[model samples]
Target: GSFAVSSFVSTIGKSAFSLPFEDGSGAALAADAGSLAGYVYLNAGGTLVRQPGPVVGAELSWNGLRLTVTASLPAEAGISGYTGKPTCVSLSGPVAAGGSEYDVTSVMDGAFRSCKTLASASLPGVEEIGKESFYGCSKLVSVSIPDAKSVGVKAFARCSHLSELDMGGHLRTVSAYAFFGCSALASFDGGGSLKTVGSYAFSGCSSLRDVSLGPALATIGAKAFASCPIESVDLSPVLKTVKDQAFAGLEFRDSGGSVLAHTAAALRGHAFSGSGGVLVAEQ
Candidate 1:
């Protein structure tokens, strides 16, 4: 069986193919998407192509083109054999095998963890990212994952050099410690679609200064945005809940430009911890 992705094709639609891999042990192909995980392909032009080769002995290399993942990734999907030679990685569309297409939906735990040499990523069609998937990738700098829905715990933690994030619509939850310790992260553009932010999601992002949360945000969990240097954020009015220390160590301001205790009606216990600063509600 072979899979091929055509070149010049910019966007691969969701659920366009079906191809999943099991653990890193062997090239164990599956009969369906749920049985395996982590299938990737290199697009050639108008086709998605893959050569049926042994995972252990495969000469895995990304010459210049980006490695596009086309299935839900399993643990160690790109970790065991990858040397991080590619400058960019993305999750898009599906891969074809035996004339059938499988959808590339989510990233599994530790799928790309510790790929210190990897630099950039683009995940336009991904629905979720698993825990510690990109953790400790010191060289990772930018990302554009537009259609993400949920980000698992510690997914991008300790990516010290990461700077840019362009989140897109349809996003929902950000799990605990999703971006913890990303010291170089400067801004987050949660573009028009987000719901809940989990505990300690953005803790220790020292360089982050600006954030644009979408209108659909509802909950901010414990220490969700702690230890950042953000000066202000325009919060959505319909926000319902905020747990303890959600905004600890952040600087906030009101519309009147006066620094005061946040009076948002949805704030729960100790919503803003260190400096009594609260996000200014955006009208």
Candidate 2:
């Protein structure tokens, strides 16, 4: 397939350089990138360490430069209400670390799953959005993740209300299911230092209208934009490859709900299966 978006449109998945690295498959990299066999400590010291929390996903904690990783949250951690699945209806706080002595990065795999009432979220200056970090945060209408370089699988899956995402121009990759099911995400401004966009990176994101691919982008993984209902998409000239099924299920209706011709042509095969809209390319 032609690498340029101007030449072709199709559907896809991605590589190891920056992997969501699920199932600890890339754990071997630890030996080469950094030591994983030792007890990482935190206290404003050496390189930061990310530990897996009781929640099954990774959590980030820092003491200036040093980071620590572990496998559980304290009994009083906000992720879990005192002793069980947080079932309270009250949303409180700038939920700080709570003076608790435990890894902060790891959250219960679904700590905030489908927390539709949440409207705003802020990542601690030191935090990185880990795998499935905010999956199903439907109520999160607006939020930010700065200093975020590497995001894991399903990091922002199903964040239906996210209208905008700012990559801060420093991000390196967009992993599988990174923004999958974020039906309300309209646009994302990536540093596009992004070398790779993985499988279903934006799968099921029906509301994304348009995005500017940065100059540094190189690869577009499978089904990266599957099932999105946008009217048009503008791609960067610097792109080198767009894998199979990378742009599936894409079509848009204007104020009057009419499908634009160019949008239909370019996304012919990539458009969603159930959608009757035709793919049309831009002039």
Candidate 3:
């Protein structure tokens, strides 16, 4: 069986790991670097790589300062497979490079996929969250993203426990399948800044009860809210276009509200198939 060796010796600027000598000629190293607890080691061909990761039972990861000068996170910002399941995760705040601090502006694709025990997250400075960022985080209950402008495809899919999401004021677009299978998501107010809700964006969110369509909304793509259990919807008067089956299988009734009237007039054919409902004014 093979074994690992580590040392406490620190490099000039970045963290480095002492590799197991293949030729077996150097002095042996010991496990003295106890402070770098969550660092993961990977054997790359013959070189050993070290990266920051989640702790044994930590409630958060990426909670400290890091260097950020590249287009994407350095393969270490995302974490998974912790022995002690974490209930909370916060991937936000600042990064440093050349002694200057920069706000973490984006979450990379598939950042926290399959983290089943994660229950909450708060991304403060993030402007864009990539595809499948929190996919399969089944226990996720809440999310708060203060600066997000766009949510990527399937970003929060399969989050069965996700009940609340505060998509702060600056959001512009909700991509396809963004909240697919999020059964517990019950509310969303895309604020006046929202423009587009892509295809299947909120499809299969069966527990969703209501939606407040923002004043600036223009497009609702195909099956945008299909299969939701919403009872009421305040469709924006400014809403112009709705694609195929955008609101299919919903439980909303034509409450005779002017908002519903305007929405009915704009809906494409068969938009509400299962509800035996159409946007008709109340008699």
Q: Pick the candidate with the highest TM-score.
A: 1
List TM-scores for all candidates, in order: 0.64, 0.53, 0.63
- What is candidate 1's local distance difference test score? 0.63
Worst 10 residues of 1 by lDDT: 71-80
Error of 3 at 220 (Å): 0.5
> Which candidate would rank higher by TM-score, 2 or 3?
3
Residue ranges of candidate 1 with Cα displaced over 4 Å:
1-85, 97-99, 251-259, 266-283
Assess the local accuracy of residue 231 in candidate 1 as a C-alpha lDDT between 0 and 100. 52
Count steric clashes of candidate 2: 35
Pull out the clashing pairs in model 3. 256-282
- Candidate 2 per-residue C-alpha lDDT over 46-143 given as tens digits, one digit per residue, 9 for 90 to 100: 22333432332233332221123333323122232122222222222222332335433323334456665566654433234567656777777766
**Over the stretch 6-45, how does candidate 3's per-residue lDDT look in tens digits?**
2222432233434442222223323344432234445656
Global fold similarity of model 3 (TM-score): 0.63
Clash count for each candidate, listed in order shown: 23, 35, 1
lDDT of each residue in 175-229, candidate 1, tens digit only: 8999999999988866667878899998999887776676777788888888887
The positional error of residue 63 in candidate 1, measured at the CA in angstroms, is 9.3
